[model samples]
Target chain A: MIEAQTLTKRYGAKTAVDSISFTVQPGKVTGFLGPNGAGKSTTMRMIMGLDNPSGGQVIVNGRPYAKHKAPLHEVGALLDAKAVHTKRSAYNHLRAMAATHGIPNSRVNEVIELTGLGAVAKKRVAGFSLGMGQRLGIAVALLGDPQTVIFDEPVNGLDPEGVQWVRHLARDLAAEGRTVFLSSHLMSEMALTADHLIVIGRGRIIADAPIQDIIDGQSKARVRVRADRPQDLLGPLAGDGVSSQVLEPELLEITGVDPRRIAETALRTGVLVYELTPLQLSLEDAYMQLTQAEVEYQSHSLSPTAPDTTQLTIPVEGRRP
Target chain B: MSAQTTTSPSPTRHAPRPSSGITFSRVLRSEWIKVTTVRSTVILIASTVLVMVGLALLGAWGYAQLAQSINDGSLPADLQAQGPGSPAVDALTTPSSGLIFGQLLIASLAVVLIASEWATGMIRSTMVAVPGRTPALLAKTVVVAAVAFLVGLLSALVSYLIAQPILGSQDLDFALTEDGVLASIINTGTFLALVAVISMSLGILLRNTAGGVVTAVGIFFVLPVIMQLLSGLADWVTDAARFLPGEAGNKMVAVTASEGALTQLQGGLVMGAWALAFLAAALIVTKKRDV
Candidate 1:
């Protein structure tokens, strides 16, 4: 288990990680989700005792990481894929790391085989592709057989197959009762792999709950309707918490109301409803809704100077004067 | 894709935690592995020994030729008048004559060993394994200093044996039993070991290979030259320069102390003090700063 109490980190005038408190439980996969530079990496580094926290402290398995007599046995972290010396062969690199804790070379070779690095285990890491580097990083993390495993952007440069492998590996480790805390910027990936998520934005905890709760909480029911007159149905649907967007002259997408209600309104308005489909909000959409305002490096859409005003309209409740 | 080969090993459920952990000896072993695994470290060590021994042979040859000239009375009267100290007695210092270059190579090697970890981002892995930070740094220093001492000791011993034949040609050969000769040879190792500690401390402080190398060269090479150029300016300049690490360490390997110069014990203490000071600062800074 990892517990951070008011952990904070500040670089000069910029606060990279605000005072945040959370706990990572064992026996499940906990995903740390954040956008770029949102302090996910910094938080992980702090947990590993690589960076000193500014005001608070983080402890792994009941003590600060450095205080443990056997730190490697308590927590193993792959903070960065390129953390190995490039001049050393992958086999030697793992051996060197294993030596600190007196971990046997047999375990080193075991990790090498488990990570599928046997083919190039003797080759220098300088020649490794990014995917191969990630594999080596994973191998290093697994060498100690720690109770808690932390991976930061483990699939950054992996292929689809490698990505799937990491997902399975994470789940398998958690199934074995190890604390698995993985970080990623992609929420869709978390949706598939994470049992619980702790989302951060701008150095603050935006959400900390089970994955399903976050999806269900932020995603209201949205429906698509094809009618003879979209504006007629939209006018009757205009009320508190109801928003509608006219897609075309006769089609509209409405939120905060179910499809059956939309059909009832369309029928009462004497508007013919040809297509009425209830749209399920993807996790990506829910993630966007959670982080849209907090995105530090928000990119403006292309052609911002000239928008197609006719094609889009604000919800009736949020329309400007 | 090779991902198909990535199989999950059944993690031994509740395997008894191994009793071994990050002890100083284990950290030393880890650091030794790190030092020897890099090909360049082996090459540098080998070259240091070779250059030191090679330079001693050259010095022996030069001293032999000078003695031959004095014997034939072919030298100018003024050149010959400098007396026994010129070639015969000076042969005792030949075993360590390569120290001038040996220290340079050893200093560079020590700096590269520590600084390259930061350059290649390997320090993270190192710090993660030994998060207390001091043990890892201390172990690396011990390993590096031990290697340097062996390099210096072996170089001097080999030089002493190899130079004997050449020195004997001029009747200038000496025994290890000669007063201070054995000490000088062994001190050659002591001197390089001190150089290694100081350079590795610089590596830890700077955390940049190029910057560490430059700073080490400045301390050991350029500072003495600058001191010499300014020694004529004042008596204090000359007096204060004697305490510089390079000046003091040079005296440690001397066959005989010059008039008003530091003795071997004094020189070793001064240089050792400097090494300790630098290493202490490095450890304190590293403990406080983020990796």
Candidate 2:
């Protein structure tokens, strides 16, 4: 188990990670989600003892990381893929790291074959591709076989097959009662792999719960309608926490109201409703809703004439349980 | 990328034994592996030995020509008047003469060994394995310093053997049992080990390969030349310059002490002090700051 208490990090005048506290439990995969520059990498670095915290502390397996007898065996982390020497072979890099803990050479070869780096284990890391580099990073993380494993952006450059492999590996590790903590920008991948989640925004925890609870809490009834007059159909459906976006002259996407309510309103108002469709809230949409206000580098769409692009400007007020 | 790669064995199979952990000896072993696994380190070490011995041979040949000119009465009037010392006594320094270039290469090698870890982003992996930070840094320093000491000792030993024949050609040969002769050969290694310590400390403080190399070169090479140019301005300048690391280390390997100059023991102590000061500052800073 990994526990952090009021962990804070500041660089000069700017705060990279605010005073945040959370716990990662064993026997499940906990996903760390945040927007760009939201302190995901910095948090991981502090946990690995690479970056000193400005305040408070983080503990792994009942003690601080450095206080452990064998830190590599206590916790293994892949904070960055480029952490190995470019000129050294992948096999040699693992050997050198393993030597610090008196780990034998046979185990080093085992990781090499396990990561499928046997074909190029003897080759220098300078020649490895992006996918191959991720494999090497994973190989290093699995070298000591610690009870807790942390990976930051593990599938950033992986292919589809590589991505699936990482997903399964995370699940398998968690199933064996190990604490698996991972971070990724791919929401779909996270949805498939993570059992629980700790979402951060602007260095603060926005949500911490089971993955299904997060999805359920951030979504409400959303309905899409095509009618002769969208404004007329939306006129009576404006209150009760309801909102609508005009997609076209005859189409409207409404939130906070169900399709049956819209159909009853159209029938009572004497408006012709051609189609009424209710959309299920996907993890991507829920994530956007949760982090819309916390995004640091929001990109403004340049194509202002696009009809569907108008919804991007709407404010999403988070409704939490 | 293969499907079978994901089918890793259980964590229990790879769990370390209860007795295995981070020890000073284990850290030292890890550092040794790191130094030898890289190609640049091996190449630099071999070249240091070769260049040191090769330069000593050239020094021996130059001294032989000088002794011949004095015997043939073909030496210039200024050269005859300013003989500095007998050519026989001057030839005693031939075994360590290569130190002129030896120090440069050794200093660069020491800086490269530590700074390259930061340059290639390998320090993160290193620190992750040994998070206390002190053991890993000290282990690397010990390995590099020990390698520098052996290179210096072996280079001087080989130069002494090969330069003996050339010195004998001019009747300027000296025995290893001569006063201060064997001490000079041994002190050559001691001086280089100190140089490596100081240079590696610079690498840790700067944490940039080019910056560390430049600063090391300035301390060992350029600083002495700058001191020489200012010596005529005041006697204090000349006195203070003697305490500089490069100047003090040169005295540590001198065949004979010049009048009013630092003795071999005093020179070694001064350079050792400088190395310790830099290393202490580096350790304190590394402990407090982020990697």
Candidate 3:
């Protein structure tokens, strides 16, 4: 398990990671969610004891990473792919790390095989393609059989097949009762792979909950109502805690009310409802809303193109505004 | 893709942790592996050894010719007055001459071993593996210093032993048994080791290859030259310049200290001060700063 308490990192007057606190529990994959320069990488570096926090501290297992007698056994982190010396072969790179811990060569070769790097393990890392370099990073992370595995943007340069492999690998690592924490700027990537999420924006914790809770709490649940007499149903659906939008001539999108209530209203009012489907909120939508106000580097358009959906999440209740 | 190839192995692939995690020996072993694993680094190291030995052999040949001139009484009056057979004696010290040029290559080797890690972003992995930080830095220093010193010592021995015949032609035998000669040869190796240590400290402090190389070259080569150009203009210039790392190293490894030069012990102390200062700075910066 990794626990960061009130960690802060500042460069001059600009704060990179400003007093953020979170805990990554064991036996589950906790996805670190943030946009670029949102302190995700800085937080991970601090957790690994690579970067010293300007304030507060991060600890792996029960102690700070450097304080552990066997740090690699406690936590293994891949902060960046292609962090190997270009002059050395991948095999030597892993071997050197193993030597520090008196870890055996058999395990080095095992991680190499596990990460699909056996084919090019002997080649110099300078010649590796991006995907191959990423695989080597994963191999290094797995070399110690560490209890907590942290990967920062592991699939940044992977192919579709390789991406699929990483997604499963993280889940499998967690299934073996390890604390697995991964970070990605791509919300969709975390949505598919993460069991729980810790979202940060502008170096602060924006949201922390289970994946399902984040999707439900940050975004309103919309219901798709299709009926032969949809206009008649719209009148009955107009009430407190209920809002409707006309998606089509025969279809209405209703929010802030359950489908059962809509179905009962249609029956009591004699509206001929053909279909009632509850719309599921994708994690992507939830993330966009959660971080829309906190995005640090934003592209400002001089004029409108299409509706700027990524920039502004549509508010469900205009009554308060 | 090759996971199937491991099917015949033991069912469990989990690694058993060693009892001691950060033993100095293990860190040293890891450092040795890192310093020797690169092909270019290996080639450069081998080249340094060959150059050390090769230059001594060439200097021996050149000194043999110079011995004949001194014996024929063709040398200048003032040159002869400095010391009747100083050229021949200095000629027997061909290994120190080789060290002048050889230190550059070996010092550069030390710089690249550490600074290039930052250039290629490999320092991240290195720092991650050994977050205690000093062990890795000190381990790297020990490995490079040991290799450079041993190579230098072997070259000095071969050079001194082989130069006997050439210097004997002029009846000038600066024997290894002579007072302070053996110590000079040993100091020749120690000076080279100091060069490596100082270069590595510069590399770690700068964390940039070009910058570290420039600073090392300036300290070893340029500073002494600048001191010489200003020598006659100021009394303190010559004396102060004698404490620079290169000049101090020269005095420390000479058969005897020259006129107006520091004694061997004083010279060694000065250079040691330099090496220790650099090392302390590197350790402090490494520990206090973010990787």
After the best TM-score superposition of candidate 2, give how far the Cα of residue A219 lies from its true spot, in angstroms.
1.3
Model 2 Cα shift for residue A185 (angstroms): 1.6
lDDT of candidate 3 over B200-267, digit per residue (tens): 99999999988998999999999999999999999899889989998898887777666778877888
Better of 2 and 3 by TM-score: 2
* Residue B120 C-alpha lDDT in model 3: 91
lDDT by candidate, in order shown: 0.89, 0.87, 0.84
Off by over 4 Å in 3: A224-253, A260-277, A300-321, B1-20, B73-85
Candidate closer to the true structure by DockQ (higher is better), 1 or 2: 2
Compared with the true structure, the alpha-carbon lDDT of candidate 2 equals 0.87
Q: Is candidate 1 or candidate 3 better by DockQ?
A: 1
Instruction: Evaluate residue B8 in candidate 1 and report its C-alpha lDDT on the 0 to 100 scale.
Output: 42
Q: Candidate 2: list runs displaced more than 4 Å.
A: A227-239, A263-272, A305-321, B1-16
1 or 3: which has the higher lDDT?
1
Model 1, B193-262: lDDT tens digits are 9999999999999999999999999999999999999999999999999999999998988887889999
Across B20-93, the per-residue lDDT of candidate 2 in tens digits comes to 78999999999999889999889999999999999999989988999999999998988889846778888898
Q: What digit string (tens of lDDT, one per residue) describes model 3 on residues A241-287? A: 77887767887788888999889989998988888877666677778
Q: What CAPRI-style quality would you assign to candidate 2?
A: medium
- Give fnat (model 2): 0.66
Model 1: lDDT of residue B67: 89
Which candidate, 2 or 3, would have the higher DockQ against the true structure?
2
Query: Can you write out model 2's per-residue Cα lDDT over A1-321, one digit (the tens) per residue?
Result: 899999999999888889999999877788999898889999999999999999989998888898988888878888888888899999899999999999889989998998789999999999998889888888889888889999999998889999889899888887777889998766777888888888888888888888887887766777778999788877788897898887778877898998888999999999999988766656676777787777888787778865444444333334221
